[model samples]
Target: MPKKKKITPNPSGSQLHAQRISELMLEKKALDIKIIDVRNITTLTDFFVICTSESEPQSRAITDHVNLTMKTEGHASWHTEGYQYLDWVLVDFVNIVVHIFSKTAREYYEFERLWADGTITEVQDEV
Candidate 1:
C-alpha cells in the first residue's frame, strides 16, 4: 500500500484567489476551466484563469460576474479588453488575468499551448 502525501495549503493567498475565480467560472458554467500559475514564467501576473464560454453572451456574463465579484473584494482590473466583440473577453487584474473565450475563439487562441511553461491546473466542474 502506498502512503498518501499530505496536501498543504498555499500561504501566498494567490492560490486561494485562483481557486475562487475557478469556482466563480464554474458557477457561470464556463467550460474547460483551468488555472495556470505563471509566477516563474512571467512577472506579468501570478496566475491565469482560462475558460471557454458557449457564446459571446456567455463570455460577457462570465466576465461581468468576475469583475463584480472582484470589485466586492476591493480588487479591480488594471485593464480589460475584447468586451466589444466578446469573442474573447480578458479581465486583467494585476495578480490574475482571466481569459474568457467563446468556443471558436478559444480553439483559435490556444492560450494553454502558448503558456505551456506555467504549471497548469485543470478545474473540475462543481456538482
Candidate 2:
C-alpha cells in the first residue's frame, strides 16, 4: 500500500494579504467575511476576500479603508470597479482581490458559492 503525503498549510504572501483584509473587514464591521484561496484552482488571482455591508455607504467605507490600509503597506490596487454605486465595490490588488458588497448585492452574486472550488477560510467578526 502507498502512503499518502500529508499537506502542511503554510501561510503564503497571498494568505497574509487575505488575513489583513479579513481583519480590516472586521474592523469596519463588515459581516460574513470569507477568505477564499484560489491558488491551486486558478492562475488569475491567489485570494479573494469577500465581505458584506449593511448599507451602500458602509460598503464604500470598507473599500476605502482597505485601499488606504493596503496602500500604506506599499501595495496599491491594480484596478477598482463599482465605487460609484457602492453596491459591489471590487478592489483589486493583483494577488488579492477584495469584494465589498451590500447585503442584497452579496446575496445576488453569491461569490462564496461561485468560488466553491477554492479553500475557504471564514473570518470571524470582532465587531
Candidate 3:
C-alpha cells in the first residue's frame, strides 16, 4: 500500500475570508488575535479566528461587527452563539468560525494549543 499524503495548509485558499474576520475582530480591539489554519486537519472549517475580549461589552462589539460587516460584504454567518453571556461568542460563516473570548475563557480553553496540528498564526494588533 502507498503511504498517505500529508495535506499542507494552502495560503491562498479560504484565507481571505479568515483574514477579513480577523480584521473585523481587530476593529473592535480584540486581543491576542490568532488565525488557526485547520484546513489540513479538519473539514469543520478552513480556519478558526480566535481572539480575547477585554470585557463583555467588547466581546459583543466584536461579534456584532464581524456579523454585520460580513453581511454587508456579501457573506453572512451560518450561525452564532454565546451572546447572552459573552464568555465566548462564536460567529460561524461556513468557511470560518470567529471566536471572541474573554481573558479567562481564552486562557481556560486554550484553543490554539488544542489545534496545535494546524498552522497557528498570531495577528499583530494595529497601532
Candidate 4:
C-alpha cells in the first residue's frame, strides 16, 4: 500500500473563515454545525463547515445569513452553488466552504462519512 500523506495544520485564513461561517450558522439557528479539516485528504478545499437547518426555508436562511454576514464583514465568496434547490447550499470562501443543508438532505449526502479521516470539530451555539 502507498504511504499515507501527512495532514498539515489548517492555515490562519482557513481557521478564521471557518469560525466566521460557524458563527453565522449559529446565528441562523443551524443545527449541529461542524468544522472538518479536509486539507490532508483533498486540496479542493481547506476546510468544510457543515450544518443543517430544520427545513428548506431555514436552510436558505442559513446560507443567506452566512453570505450576507461574510460580505458585510469584508469576506466575499469566490463562488456559490445549490441555491435554487435550497436543499443544500454551498458557499465557497476560497479557503473555507460552507454547507447549509436541510436535515434530510444532510443525512442523505453523508459528507461526514466521505471525509471521515479529517479532524472533525463540533461547534455548538450557546442558547
Candidate 5:
C-alpha cells in the first residue's frame, strides 16, 4: 500500500501547542496526562492530549483552563464536544485535540489502548 499523506502544517508548533495544553491540564491538577503523537500513525491530527480528572467539576475545569489558555495563546479551538455531560469533554484545535475525561469515563473508554501504536508521552510536573 502507498504511504499515507501526513497533515502536518507545522509539526514543531503543533508539538509545542500540545505541550502547552498538557501544562494547562497540569495546572488544573489533571492526573495521568498523556500526549499521544499520532502523526506517523494517522492523518487525523498531530497530537492527542489526554488527561483525567477526579470528578465532573474537575473535568469541566480542565477543559475550561485549556480552552482559555489556548485562546490567550492566540489559538482558538476549532470545535469542542461532550461539554453537556462533563464525563469526557474534547477541546479541538486544528492541529491538537485535548481530551478532558473524568476518572471513570477515562477508565471506561481506555483511549490509549486503542492508539497503542502511536508514540505516547506521559507529562509530569512538580506542580
Candidate 6:
C-alpha cells in the first residue's frame, strides 16, 4: 500500500496572496467572487478564491489576468492546472489557490458546498 502524502501549510504570504488573487478576479469581472478560509478545515491550502466567469473565454481571461497581474506585482503561481479544458482553471500560489470556473462547471463543482464548514466570505464586485 502506498502512503498518502500530507500537505504542509505555507504560512508565508497566505492572506496577502489570497487577497491579491481575489482582487485580480474582481478586476477581471469574475462574478460571485468567494473567499474560503479553509485553514482550520484543511492543511493543503490556507485559502480558496472561487469565482465564476461568464464563459470559457472569460474563464481563460480571468485566469490570464490573475497570472499576469500577480506576476507583474511580484507574485507568481507555483503551479497552474486545468487550462486545456478552460471550464475550470486553477492557479496555485502555494498558500493561495485561485479557481476560475465557467458558470455551469462552477455550479457542478459546488466547491462552496464541499467546503461548507470553512469560513466563506463573499467578495463584492464593484462593477
Best model number under lDDT: 5
Quote the positional error of residue 28 for candidate 2 in Å.
Answer: 0.7
Instruction: Report backbone clashes per prediction.
Output: 0, 0, 0, 0, 0, 0
- Model 1 bad stretches (over 4 Å): 1-9
* Model 1 vs. true fold: TM: 0.89
Candidate 3, residue 101: CA error in Å?
Answer: 0.6
Best by TM-score: 2
After superposition, candidate 4 runs with Cα above 4 Å error: 1-11
- Comparing 1 with 2 on TM-score, the higher-scoring candidate is 2
Off by over 4 Å in 6: 1-12
Question: What TM-score, to 2 decimals, does candidate 3 have?
Answer: 0.88
lDDT of each: 0.89, 0.90, 0.90, 0.88, 0.91, 0.87
Task: Estimate, for each residue in 1-127, the C-alpha lDDT of model 5 and write its tens digit.
Answer: 9999988786599999999999998898999999999999999899999998898888888888888888998998999999999988988897898898888888898999999999999999874
Residue 22 local lDDT, model 4: 93
State in Å the error of residue 34, model 3.
0.3
The digit string of per-residue lDDT tens for model 1 on 32-76 reads 999999999999999999999998778888988988997898777
Query: Distance from true position, residue 50, model 6, in Å?
Result: 0.6
Per-residue CA lDDT of model 4 for 11-57, tens digit only, reads 58878889888988888788989999988888888899999889888
> What TM-score does candidate 6 reach?
0.86
Model 2 residue 70 CA deviation in Å: 0.6
lDDT accuracy of residue 106 in candidate 1: 85
Off by over 4 Å in 2: 1-9
| RMSD over all Cα atoms, model 5 | 6.7
TM-score for each predicted model, relative to the true structure: 0.89, 0.90, 0.88, 0.87, 0.89, 0.86
- For residue 100, give model 1's deviation from the true position in Å: 0.4
**Candidate 6 lDDT over residue span 6-91, tens digit each:** 99976457777787788888887889998898999899999999998898888888888999988898887889999999988999
Error of 6 at 120 (Å): 0.5
